[model samples]
Target: MKSQRFLKFYQSESEKYHGLRYGGLYGKLFKTLHHEALSGFLVQADNSEPILEIACGTGHTTGLLVKEGFDVIACDLTPGMMQRVSEQTGDQHEKVSFVRMDAFKLPFPDACVSTVVSTRFLHLFPADEQELIITEMYRVLKPGGVVLVDFDSWVHRWCWALPFALYNLLRYQRLAPYSIYNRIGRTITMASRVGFSDIKVDGIGGAQLLLPALISGSTALKVGRMHRRSVLRLIADQFMVCGKKY
Candidate 1:
């Protein structure tokens, strides 16, 4: 039932309340990760060509893309999210357009878009459905255009993995779910199957490391400055998988 809804169906309640709440807290942390993922594509973007953002929740990323002079078509499965995006942008924002649509089955014509970007949407799907989603993304992108997918990493859960599991069980008691796969690896492999080339993954934040860093005082911050890469590698909560449609 969950697989069917995620793959072939669109649910507003899932996209609105469940999706947005999770995004609100995790979104800020992954902005840096998104920037890194988008770096090359944003530089290459013509700004005049159409860009599509699937599952564009509150339009935070869409708004940023619009401000950068891109013609963005932002779509989500939820009407409430689309309305929220419109309200967030105000009526005067001409560069942005909103549509309500499912990610797994996009409504856009083939090869019509210069790029497709969807952030923080993969974990919602089981593995096979995730592959289907990537296939859909690849199908719509123009040749040489890129697909950028940002998702939570397995490494991030290391901080409080057991506790997080317990908390989810308690808070979402009625949901009846579990982590179905190692989302990070699954996303990478799925993108590869969809013919995405030049795939890359990177760490986002030092959230976990910060906990221990707090204990060491000035020495920790100093150590953080020198060994930033090491800290980021260990405490990465976000991962971006990017590739070009070939």
Candidate 2:
């Protein structure tokens, strides 16, 4: 029932979701790291096969994939979200195939797709479910295929614990779920259990809680970029995990 509600909520929110999440300077910082991390992992994917992007809300990643000239399967549960992707990638409609399906039980054969991606999706669920989703991603990937998933970090949020609490308090958010995959160790363990080899993580989007809110956009951009490659990246707010099925 809650899952259905989430789907319905995103159904109504599809039109405004992009602006709501990626509007201001902080938003730009987040989006920049997201695009950078996803693109970096994508270039390493097997170009000969199609890419399956789960929960492709509002088509941000979908647009990027389309622009890169790969055949893409942009799967989401909400009709509105898929429609948004259609509108967003208007010029290359032929390259993107929209499918409305649940990510928990992907409707595809095993060892079929070359690349599987899920962004901003795992952090929404509990640890066990994350394992299930990762297992599913692995099952569908062809041998030597790559899977990349990016999510919000618990450690990063905890680093800004006071500000996050105050921010949520201001919005009347009294409760939230915690992600156990807060660092690379837990994430790597999950990948190994799912039979994924060559598992690695890339941290991105740091300094959100520590940086001054009034800092200029360029400065924030630098902070975000620096965290992505720096040795201190694991402490950043968001990170991407790339694993291979071989």
Roughly what TM-score does model 1 have, to 2 decimal places?
Answer: 0.75
Q: Give Cα distance to truth, residue 186, candidate 1, Å.
A: 4.7
Model 1 agreement with the true structure over 1-246: per-residue lDDT tens digits: 554454343344534543444353343333434554466447655566867988877665676677566778888876555555654455536877877777767897888887887866776767787788888888888898877776656665767677667867886673334344245566677788879888765555535545544575444444333322344644566565668877
TM-score of each: 0.75, 0.90
**How many residue pairs clash (N, CA or C atoms closer than 3 angstroms) in each of the candidate models, in the order given?**
0, 0
Residue 37's lDDT in candidate 1: 45
Model number with the top lDDT: 2
Off by over 4 Å in 1: 1-29, 32-41, 87-92, 169-171, 174-186, 209-231
Question: Per-residue lDDT tens digits of candidate 2, residues 194-216?
Answer: 99988778887765623643556
Candidate 2 colliding pairs: none
TM-score of 2: 0.90
Q: Residue 198 of model 2: what lDDT?
A: 88
